[model samples]
Target: MNDELRLKIEEYLGGIMSTSEATLFEQEMARNSELKEEVILQKQINHHLRDDKLNAEIPENEYTRRIRTYVKSDEAAHIKQVLKGVEKDYKERVKKPRRKNLMVAAILIGALLLSGIGYWYTSQATPQELYASYYSTNDLPSVIQRGDKDSKLAKGAVAFQENNFELALNYFSEYIESTSELDPFVYIYIGVINMEQGNIASANMALDNAIDSNTLDSSRGLWFKALTYLKAGDTENAGLFLKKLVESTTNFNYSKAKDLLEKL
Candidate 1:
């Protein structure tokens, strides 16, 4: 590409182009396949360079110099050609309006780049980072009125929703000890609380009890167990549980487990 076209692509990718300019540029890209490919290449290159960990590992000037050199190499040319093919196939298979097509084109290129870089990203991520990314209490059972507000179960559930894990644990423990026929979900609450507190062994034991309960929600424990292992950086064990989760479409977080399995 000529220097002026390259500069324009950079400006567009950089979001420095004004509204009218961006609109015109998109129109230009629609008519010019080569411009679209160049834009995709630049976006991917920018993404790699902007990665925090990558920037930390390599000196700024040196990394930029190396990346610029690679961008001008035969390997990058081959990649652009491959991207061109991907765009062509994607366009042929899916029909959408012009603006939506442009958006999908960007997304498709991003997905392609992610596929290539996913392993590197996953490997570099700390176990804690992965856990933080996936672990959420929002989906957990919420407080329900069990007729008596003073009941241990009600108290525990309320505390859990309030983020008072310590209080919740105590209430949950009391509830478990008070009954022979325990609700399997009580064990899940305890497991999640323990896991949040970094009590991995206690968390695993509680989760195991939930799983072994064989209730309708037993599969819920499996998902947490996978996450427990993931939080511990035990990818092998995590993958095993994640695989089990994906076996049934009805399993809790089946699609999410499948996606997480790919990362593992």
Candidate 2:
């Protein structure tokens, strides 16, 4: 590769490439296996170069200067010799070698524990994915009073029970417009319907209304609101609600909330 292309690759690996340039480069990589391999190799080298803990006993500037000088030089054997000398010097200078060994051991142990924890975390589904796994219309409040005989509210409840979310939502909307005393459960139903349809923001707004109305068990509203945030991958907000649910013994799903909080 030309010097300009080499420098561009370096810049890209360093994350300093402009958005448009990065987009173009990614498009190029899609078509070029050799370019992709070169980029991956550069990234691996960059990772080692960025690790400050690599040669902790060496003075930062002196070690950096040695590395840069060796890399820039054309003499490959000289580079190996210099690196060996650097390592030997660090080992010789550490008079308390046993203490250094203990410190290194401690670091290694901590790193292993962290790596295990990270693997466990990443191996599990994300909050959004977990929400999908746990979610069910059965969790929603059952239609207790199907309203006046053959009423829109009754029809909406039937549709909701039948899993026809859109039709249920439409019926509920018409009922809300027709009635003066709006049932808070209607808002809860609407919110849940929106959530099932993946309309996160709308679900949240309706759940908020349910909470503010102070009708229908507001704890259920809070629980569903938290689930809405969880489904949308807003774990911060979801955690807040989950914490609240855990604190409230009266919430129906307190145990489930506690379980979800532990995952977060």
Candidate 3:
């Protein structure tokens, strides 16, 4: 847990560094999902595990009550007899239809409950997957909208990263004109390149599009939008965008948004 590496990753995420640096950081991040998840979780825990944050400030009696809350209900202690082998041992007519129905119903109920819980757990995935799922789920307007233009946006991102802002701007503009299905992130990066090159109007437009463009889900996409707005000095919209991201797993953005909110 070197502070230097931590800061380096954060800076890379903020788009202030070179692509080679970011690629290295991303390679490390992608080496293991658990390691990357742990990295984010540590950042979150460091922010929230503060003296004044939660447990430390609670009264002894309240804390004791919180502990008691985990005690199981009476139903958890109560045991139910399971008819495990009854179904297999009997033919349809050998057992009463009523008995068969009850067993089948119970098994289905258990399965449904288990499936529901599993689905809920899956839905609570990390934000990056959330964004990816969001992108993939939309079907991307299947028309291709225009031929070969999508690749130009990708090229634009690379050019922008290389600081060829004018060339990046042209590619982005061409890509933008070709299709409406562009990933919102491209708009952010394209806008940022424009911003850095002092094309305030286009920069504002690009970031605004990133913020306003339709997407399948609201992961930290709102965070990107908020950052773009902030960079554009549109604090009003930025604050509003950040407000929607408060309860998400996007704690890095949540804390950053809190800072922006305070300043506003």
Candidate 4:
């Protein structure tokens, strides 16, 4: 591709294009298969570059193995040659006034080559793997001792902790039906139980209730909702909720949500 076209592709993928510009670009891509291919290639390159800093720490042999496994096209060979040239230029220009740009270019090219492996691995991760990696019940509130021990909420909490999801759901349902003043946390518990049972639609409904509760811990619902989508392999929807969680520093699991968003 020409340098101008390449730059435009980069800008488009970087989300720097205005809506009208992006629409025009999409129209152009639809009419030009080569342009569309270039755009896809640029997206792959950007995906690999997103975690460049982390890829820098990988051992060279392991990195090379990964690259060999995932990248076999002539384009990859061209990228290798370009990276070598950038490295050579960087070494030769280390003491010059233009060293900064050379350094950045070298790093970018090196990362482009190395990080494809990481990107491939990330892309290969199953939705179940992602869910298992991020999901945990440890942070859930302990409701066993709250209020009366004989209360339905307390029984539900105990059942949930014991992995008796069916019993927990029953007790939680009873608790909800008995009260005009709903405990938002109970909805969260219901959501978690339903999610564990693979009832995605029901889980989402309960989570929605928790969010609409407008209570202090309402943000917790966002995190669980993201996990629900992740478990269901609906990463696009998962990202929506994760983005909401990361918008406020005080939001539950804000840092984790931010990290997960990057992975997605």
Top TM-score model? 4
lDDT of 1 at 180: 94
List model 1 lDDT by residue over 7-37, tens digit each: 9998998899999999999999999999988
Q: What does the lDDT read for residue 207 in candidate 2?
A: 85
Q: lDDT winner among the candidates?
A: 4
Candidate 4 residue runs with Cα over 4 Å from true position: 1-124
- Local accuracy of candidate 3 as per-residue lDDT tens digits, 1-264: 678866765676457879887778778889967557655665555557553354243335876786666445453333221133345546653556786567655654654454445434433434333333222212212223333545886677567656687787788678778876756656666655654455656666665565555563333356555554555555556555555554343433566555444444
Q: What's model 3's TM-score?
A: 0.35
lDDT of each residue in 137-183, candidate 2, tens digit only: 66776555655747887788889888898888889899889988857
Q: TM-score for every candidate vs. truth?
A: 0.52, 0.51, 0.35, 0.53
Residues 113-231, candidate 4: write the lDDT tens digits: 54444345455566667888888887576677577889999999989989999999999999889999868789999998888788898999899889878886688999999889888
Those runs of model 3 whose alpha carbons end farther than 4 Å from true positions after fitting are 1-150, 198-201, 216-225, 228-237, 247-252
When sorted by TM-score, best at the front, the candidate numbers are: 4, 1, 2, 3
Write down the worst ten-residue block by lDDT for model 2. Answer: 114-123
TM-score of 1: 0.52
The local distance difference test score of model 2 is: 0.76
For candidate 1, give the lDDT of residue 110.
58
